[model samples]
Target: MTLTQDQRSLLTAIAQPWIDTSEWPLWANVQHQFDMRGQDADAIFHSLPRVGNEVSFASGYGYAAPMRAPIDPGHMVRLTVAGVSKLPRMRIAVGEPFMHTLRHMIDLYTRRPILVDEVPKTILRSGELTAALPKLDPWFVKVLPDLLSYEPAINTGGGAHLSDGSWEREVTRSVMQFRGMHTVEEYIEKTCEIVTKNAAQTAPFTIEEEQPMPTEPERAPYVDLALLDDLQKAAANTHWKVHKLIALCQGLNDAYKAGNPYVCAAMIRAVMDHIPPVFGHKDFKVVANQHTFMTQRTDKIHALKLVDFKDISDDGMHRQIGSSVPVLTMDNIPQPIRLNAMLQELLTILRKEAAIAP
Candidate 1:
């Protein structure tokens, strides 16, 4: 029966505290005491009758093993996360998720099973010459070998270790749909959170191929395209939010040059909220306060200045237009210490994490 993760955990806790519900065997796992493994052997399996429009045909078997699962990582498979598709071939194994792939491999080895043929003898038809004559070793009335009922292994955990278990490891997970990673900022921000709680949690990530990305501008109107620019030089790279960050910076620059102060202000605030995860934090506030690269208390203060600037951008975004407040102008959005300390932090991180082109 299908159970919610919590329900499965509760049942296991009460019925068998030693069991780890999350590691429960799948239907095709051949390591059970009886057949059907962790589920049940005596369970009734059914098949529907088919005969064109009539129910004259009933093609079914008594018992059989379930179809094998496609869990082999040697097979190349691509998965789309937040619109971009990536071949989930664990590129950087830097965290807890990396350990998970290793454990899965060990489990596969520990529970390795064997495959045996279900041999069947030729069938002797009713009142045939062989049946009418002397009897053979046993009853020979049987269908083809394929029609014989399959038997589960007799010994408990009915699988045996293979002699050679040294295949090249292909790291990948069966799950991890990249849920809640809708936006570029969310991708960066959430990746940090997940990696912190989990680790480079991109075990089966990084790009196999990607559409071409734009070159870094000869010069940006305001701040340089920090993390996103370094990322552009890297080969075979893909980040869900790379384009979005570029677009936001472009928008902010265009708004500033065009004297569109409101759009400039909004984009500034958005960029601040978006880019902090590069230095590894959920928001600019934490990044300003805690970035390890910017160790100088004074340089750290400059990072805080970027965070402080976000307040004005916030005002330009959320504050209502009223006569009591003066309208925004180009002078109002003056660059903060030539993009301040955060850019240094960004460059260091992007260089370390991404393989920049020489």
Candidate 2:
């Protein structure tokens, strides 16, 4: 698929720095660019495979899993000029050929297309790749200007610039530096480290608040149990069901205070489960489970909107995993808090509808 104009712009912006420094652009480089532009790094990073389909050099590009040993760095694999259609067939560690070919391409100053037969058996070794650099340098230099002149019309309004003296000067400087480099291996390694460090330093951009999956929401002040002592005392003369609800509310409030949010969440579900049965609505009795009871009957019978009850129940249940469990996090204080507020509202409705004292 073809890249959109925005995608192309993003790709060019990301690739230019690496090209200018004569380095192979990695996924981290793309991530860094997105971070700088305040775009979603992860979304843009995943989109590369589609964007890469348009670029000849980007075939087979993918992230390499981190090495088993902690000291080794995780990097990306990409098809360079040397690996174009052959790297996938070769037996080597991921990212090896891509890195080696990138070093060779920059050192030799050319992406000389070669047949599979021409590819060396031991291309991973720096010494073997270095031997072929001189032969490729002339071709690399010849095509250098065209490669660096990427998206010339992007900034130059649709028309191409007839003469850009600054572009020529920059290319000349880069060529001179390329010639002055002594060891291809050292240059590649240094550049790789520099790029990795720079990429690491870039923080992922924060998505706008208007977007979904908001971390926090505007909340009402927490209603402490101590402040609700009057309500609890008032329930003494009320029906047994009302007394049971008051006790559940007390337990829910106590769970929150004790920092057992999972317990609080469970208490919320418990209250919902108990309250529906107290009404004895025909629809509530017909439902197979509490999930259906809360979602359907409670809304119909009490005019209480438990539209998000299923989601709340699911989130609460998942949060009840043991401390050792790593499947889901246990930090769900808001779930119970939200449910407590809903329960409070439900209690107020019951007090008025049932005409209970106080």
Candidate 3:
């Protein structure tokens, strides 16, 4: 399959969160439990399938000693399932949503009375699967191996002594570390509001000098030969179309400006590289303002920026891990200094690339 460089970059970026903390056993067990109960495990896996469909289909299994809360024993269990395709696969760790689906399905299935003990309080925890499965196993199956169920090691006051307590401690209610997720509206309105307000309040007090718009014969927007050929086929009157091309270029610029200014500048440079002759003094000015706007309205800029790339440091500072420097602090630096630094860096790269002989 063909993919552009940026498209490939985006695909990898999108998949990284799932790839980082992949746990297969928990996902397999959850799938198996649902599968035994006539639930279509394949359907769930297919719903939000991985970038390559084959990645989700590869399967393997192993046995695991029973584990306590926070440690999923199921993830460690040994098992194997057949894949539909013979292609290689990428394994992903089971995420919270997968666990929730299993928990909810179990709750629905166990509404009727089939046991004496209260539905395992471990299951009640809504997060602990290890303790709850033991409770469910005794009632549902026979000759269940002791290894299938896990009991917590009891702490007997002092530092050295410990008790192997199967039922000594009572299961406390499971406190979900991550509760409900917020809707897009709630997050955008609340988080972005604070970000926007802070940016406006903390913006640098740079003087706005009104410069006259340039009057020298504005360069006619140029279209690539290949694209021009395509346009000629579509339009009945394929004149030089200077005005239309100019308007189209303006439209693209406007679209970029309407979004985060940093993004606008980035897109402007990107388009300029592929579509030649549009790169001029005015284009540079437009791109420059975008940098200034982003730097001045940093809170909004950071908020709009993707989480992973949000915290770019000032050029003078070495890149430090987990540094939370304020975006608009103007100590020893000129107005929008950080923005200017980044803009210069971007422009330098572009100019360097343009100078290279093809």
Candidate structures ordered by TM-score, highest first: 1, 2, 3
lDDT of 3 by residue, 1-358 (tens): 2334433332333233223332123445545555576764434333322221121111101111212234342233211111111112211222222233334334533453456866543222222333455444221112111111111111111010011211111222221211242322232233233334434443345558454454332221122222222232222232122323323334433433243334333333343332222223344333433433323565334323322222332222334446573332222222232332333333343444445625
lDDT at 194 for candidate 2? 39
In order, the Cα lDDT scores of the candidates are: 0.38, 0.38, 0.29
Q: What is the lDDT of residue 99 in candidate 3?
A: 32
lDDT of 1 at 332: 78
Q: For residues 1-358, what per-residue lDDT tens digits would candidate 1 score against the true structure?
A: 1334433322222222112221123323321333433443223211211111111111111112222233222211111111111111211111122223223333433444444775322221223323333332112211111111111110011111111211121112211223333333343234334323322221224478453444322223565422333433331142423445555665676666466788877887777788776766788888777776545777677767767777677777777867798677767774645353455556556656655534
Give lDDT: candidate 2, residue 249: 63
Best by TM-score: 1
**Model 2 lDDT tens row, 1-358:** 2445555454455445433543334556666666787886555434543212222211212222111222111132122222221223221321233334444434443433456777421112223333554443433332233233221110111111111111111111122233334443443334344334434333234565343343332222234332233234333345533545555665665565456656665666666666554344333223223323243543343333333354554665775556564332235444434444444444454455457454
Note the residue pairs that clash in candidate 3: 22-93, 23-93, 25-75, 26-75, 61-78, 61-79, 62-77, 62-78, 62-79, 63-78
- Candidate 2 global Cα RMSD: 27.5
Poorest 10 consecutive residues by lDDT, candidate 3: 153-162
